[model samples]
Target: MAASGAAVLHRAVRANLTARALALVVVVLVLVISYATSLRIYFAQAHEIATTKAEIAQSQASIADLQSQITRWNDPAYVSAQARERLGWLVPGETGYTVVGADGKPLGGGLTLDSTPTDDPGQPQAMWWDRMWGSVKAADKPAVKKADPGKRAPVTPDSKPR
Candidate 1:
């Protein structure tokens, strides 16, 4: 009876040990899965921070470029040069001459207005006011209405009244 009692006590201790080890293993697995999710979130936030920093740097660079342009535009010499190149502006005492090629196109790099005479001698040229008056006359005319070809006429059922 003493030997049987000792064997029964040993079996109970072994069963308790097995259950405790399984519970410890399950707890460790849960902790590992939670830590993995946290690490993924941390890395994703780090990537987003890097991307936002790059965008901020780009915006700063663009702002610096625009500030430099503003500084250059504040100079009178730059403004005068731009006007001369873009609008064909000339100084009060300066006479500007455009060199024309045989094809009737301006040869040099400076901007030139369309001052060339018409090639047809028989056709009378209309002045700026004449063209403006013609446009005004056209605007005064009533608009002509036309039926849409794709539009379908309404249909009445044969069983109903005509």
Candidate 2:
């Protein structure tokens, strides 16, 4: 019976080409599935990385917009307008008029006419590079050292030189 089994196995290995081909195809399919699964994981990670980069770009754009707004608001004319409208300050020779419409509302759009544009030519202009350098230097400077009380001499009232 063992001899018969061996003969049958030999005949299957040597004679049937279609059966061997099917076995090879099944092995290839398993390898392809495994590779495809790994590729899917890699692609998912790439998507996450792309999303993070997009968020970073968006944050940068927002920061740039905010910085631009700060630059504009820091102007002398704009600041003066804001201060006068918000604080109700009146400069000399500047007239204040309120024209109420049919609804009995001021046409100043929540701003008063007493606002003075403080455009002082004598004020020193700030250079962009100087400000940036100063900020960098300030950040690099070491913290202030605390006063050493122990190293200081004891103070006495009405003390004179020896």
Candidate whose TM-score is highest = 1
Q: Please list the residue runs of candidate 1 whose C-alpha ends up more than 4 Å from where it truly belongs after superposition.
A: 1-17, 108-162
> Judged by lDDT against the true structure, how good is candidate 1?
0.90
Cα deviation of 126 in candidate 1 (Å)?
16
Q: How does residue 37 of candidate 2 score in lDDT?
A: 100
Which lDDT tens digits does candidate 1 get at residues 1-162? 999999999999999999999999999999999999999999999999999999999999999999999999999999999999988898899998888899998887876568677667788888899999999999999789787757846555645443
lDDT of 2 by residue, 1-162 (tens): 999999999888786877888899999999999999999999999999999999999999999999998998989888888877786556789886668888976766555455554556687667799999999999999799998989976778877665
Please tell me which predicted candidate would have the highest lDDT against the true structure.
1
Clashing pairs in 2: none
